[model samples]
Target: MFLLSTILYDKNHVLQNNILTTLRHVLSNITMAKNEKHSVKLRIWFYSGENKVLGKGRIELLERIKETGSISSAAKGMKMSYRQAWQMVEEMNEFSKLPLVEKQLGGKSGGGTKVTEAGERAIIAFHTLENKVNAFTVKEAEKLKF
Candidate 1:
C-alpha cells in the first residue's frame, strides 16, 4: 500500500511539473509574439533640385534658433558646436528661396539672431507634412500581417 502511494505521488509530481513547464513555454511564446510585431518608420528631407536642403535636424535647429534668439545658444542646446550650427544655417540660407535666418548687429543691448518669415513657414510646413505622413503610415501599419 505504501509503495503504491509513493509511486502515485511521484507520478503526480512529475505531471504537475510538466504542466507548469508547458504553461511557461506557451506564455513566453505569447509574450514574444506580442513584442515581435512589425512597425513602420520613415525619414523625410526637402531638396533643391539635386541638393538636399532640410530635414529633421535642420528643422529642430531652426526651431531652437527661433526660441533662443542666439545661434550659439541654440547650438549649445543641441549639443553641437557653434561653427557646425553656423554652417548649417549658411547651407539652409543658400538652399532656401528666402534667407531662413538673419543676424542682428550689436547695439546697446546685444547682437542676436532671428528666424525670418520664410523660416517660420518652413517649420510649420515641415511639421504639417510630417504629421500627415505619420498618420498615413500608422493607418497602413495596421494592415501588416507579419
Candidate 2:
C-alpha cells in the first residue's frame, strides 16, 4: 500500500509539471502573436542635392509655427532652441522657390511669424506623400519574415 501511494504521488507530480510547461508555451505564443501584430510606421524626407527640402519634422515645425505664430513659441512647443528653429526656417526658405516662413519684427502688435501659401502647400504635399508611403510600407510589412 505504501509503494502504491508513492507511485500515485509521483504520477500526479509529473502530470502537474507537464501541464505547467504546456501553459507556459501557450502563453509565450500568445505574447509572440501580440508582438507580431504591431503595425509598422514610415517616415519620409525630401531632399534637393544635399539639402533637406521637407520631411515630417520640418512639416511639423511649420505646423507648429502656424499654430503659435512665433518661431520662438514653435521651438518651445517642439522642445527646440530658437536658433535651431530659425536655422531650419532659413534653410527651408533658402531651398524652396518661395520663402516658407515670414517673420515680422516687434511693433505695435509685437513680432510674429507666418506660413506662406507656398509653405501651406508644402505641408499638404508632404503629408500626402507620407500617407501614400506609409500605406505601401504597411502592406509590404505584412509579407516580411522575422
Candidate 3:
C-alpha cells in the first residue's frame, strides 16, 4: 500500500467564537509541541515516461489487429492514426525486449498484423495484474479520510 500525505484544513464548523477559543487554546498550549498541518499533497505518478508506461494502448491495438484483419482497421477502431499506433507498438516492443506483433506481407490474402505468442503473454500480464494492482490501490485510498 502507498502512504500518501496531504494538507488538510478544518473549516466546516468555523465561527468567530470558535476561532477565538481555538486561538486561546493554542496560546495556552504554546509550550506544547503542536502537530503541524500538512501544507502540500504528495501524489506519485508511477509511470512518468513514454517507455515506462505499460502500453495498454499498444496491447489493445495488437489485440484488435489480431481480432480484425488489418492494422489500419485496428488503428481506425482505436481512433488513432496508423502511424501513431505503429509508433506505440514499436516503443512497447523495445521496452519489453520482445516482438509483440508480426506482419504478413502482400498476397491475395492481403498484408496484415498479428500478435505473437510473446504479445499474448504481455497483454495478459499487463491487463490482469495491472488492473488488480490499481483496484487494490483505489480501495486503500478509499480507506483513508485525513
Candidate 4:
C-alpha cells in the first residue's frame, strides 16, 4: 500500500508539471504574437524660432475651421474653447507669410470665416509631406531588427 501511494503521488506531480509547461508555452506564444503585430505612428511638425508653424493638431484645427465656417463652431465641434481656437488661428496667421484665415464682421447675416488660398495650399503641402514621412517610417519599421 505504501509503494502504491508513492507511485500515485509521482504521477500527479508529473501531470502538474506538464500542465504548467503547456500553460507557459501558450502564454509565450501569445506574447510573441502581440509583439510581432505592431504599428508605428509618425507625427511631423514644423517649427520656426521656438514657435510651431504647422503640425498635425494645427492642421486638424484648420480643417475644422474650413468645415464649420466659424472658429467658435469649429471649437465646439472639437470640444475646445473658442478662445483656444482663436489663439491657434492667430498664431498660424502670425507665422505664415499670408493670413491663413479671414474673419468677417458679424451683422444680420452673422459672421463667418474662410480659409485663404494660402491656407489651402499649406494644408495640401502639409499632408503631402506627412504622407511621405509616414511611408518612410513604415519602411524603416519593416527593416527593424530584434
Candidate 5:
C-alpha cells in the first residue's frame, strides 16, 4: 500500500509539470503571434539639391501656421522653438519658386503670418503624394512573409 501511494504521488506530480509546460508553450506562441506582425514605415521628403525643402514635420508646421496665422503660435503648438520654426519657413521660402509663408505688417488688428496660394497648393500636393505612397507601401508590405 505504501509503495502504491508513493507511485501515485509521483505520477500526479509528473502530470502537473507536463500540463504546466504545455500551457507555457501555448501562451508563448500567442504572445509571439501578437508581437510578430510586420508593417511598413515610410517618410517622404522633397529636396532642392542638398537641402530638404519639405517633409512631414514641415508640412505639419505649414498646416499649423495656416491655422494659427502666426509662426510663433505654430511653433508653440508643435513644441518647437520659434527660431527653429522661423528657420524652416525661411528655408522653404528660399527653396520654393514662390514664398510659402508671407508676413503682414502690424495694423489696427495686429500683424500675423499667412500661407500664400502657392503654399496652399504645395500642402495639397504633398498630402496627395503621401497618400499614394502610403497605399503602395501597404500593398507591398502584405507581400512580405517575415
Candidate 6:
C-alpha cells in the first residue's frame, strides 16, 4: 500500500544528496502485507532479548475487548475464536510488566473482560506510534526506490 502510494510522492518530497539517496535506497526494500478489500496493513516480526515488538494484533484485540466489554465478544468482533483471544491475552500478560486486559468475576450479569486503563493507554500509544513509524518507513523507502 505504501509502496503504491510512493510512486506519486517523489515529486512532493524529493531529496538530492548522498545521505538522502542512501536513505531512499534502504527504504525501497521495506514491505508490508496489506488487504486489498479494506486497506488494512499487517506487520509481523519477532524480537530478541531486548524484546522489540512488531505487528498490531494484540493491541487491536485489546481494543475490541474494551469496546465489547467481554473477551468472547471481542474475539467474535475480531473474527477469532475465544480460545485464540484468550491465548493472546495470556501471552501478552506473561511478557509485559503490565497486563493488558482485566477480567471481572461473575455477578448477576456474569463475568466479562475489560481493558485496564493501562491497556487502553497501551492501545492508544501503540497505534499512534505505529502510524508514525510506518509513515517514516514509507517515506524513507521512497527515498531509496529511485
**What digit string (tens of lDDT, one per residue) describes model 1 on residues 6-59?**
456675567566556667777888888667757789989988887767899999
Q: In lDDT terms, how accurate is model 5?
A: 0.87
TM-score of each: 0.71, 0.69, 0.59, 0.71, 0.72, 0.62
Total backbone collisions for each predicted model: 0, 0, 0, 0, 0, 4
Clashing pairs in 6: 24-143, 24-144, 25-144, 27-141
Model 2 segments more than 4 A misplaced: 1-40
Candidate 3: TM-score? 0.59
Instruction: Return the number of clashes found in candidate 1.
Output: 0
Quantify all predictions' global Cα lDDT against the true fold.
0.86, 0.84, 0.67, 0.83, 0.87, 0.69
For residues 89-127, could you state the per-residue lDDT of candidate 5 as single tens digits?
A: 999989988889898779646887899999999999999
Best by TM-score: 5
Best model per lDDT = 5
Candidate order by decreasing TM-score: 5, 1, 4, 2, 6, 3
The residue-by-residue lDDT of candidate 4 on 1-146, one tens digit each, is 53444456675577566556667777888888667668888788867677887788788888998998988898898898889888988898888877889988796469978899999999999999999989999999989955
List residue ranges in candidate 6 displaced over 4 A: 1-54
Candidate 6 residues 11-103, lDDT tens each? 655523444665565666553223223333546433335663324787778778888899888899889999988888777766666766778
Q: What's model 1's lDDT at 37? A: 57
Candidate 1 has an lDDT of 0.86
Q: Which is the winner by lDDT between candidate 1 and candidate 2? A: 1
In candidate 6, position 52 carries an lDDT of: 36
State which candidate, 3 or 6, has the greater TM-score: 6
Off by over 4 Å in 1: 1-34, 105-110
Between candidates 3 and 4, the lDDT winner: 4
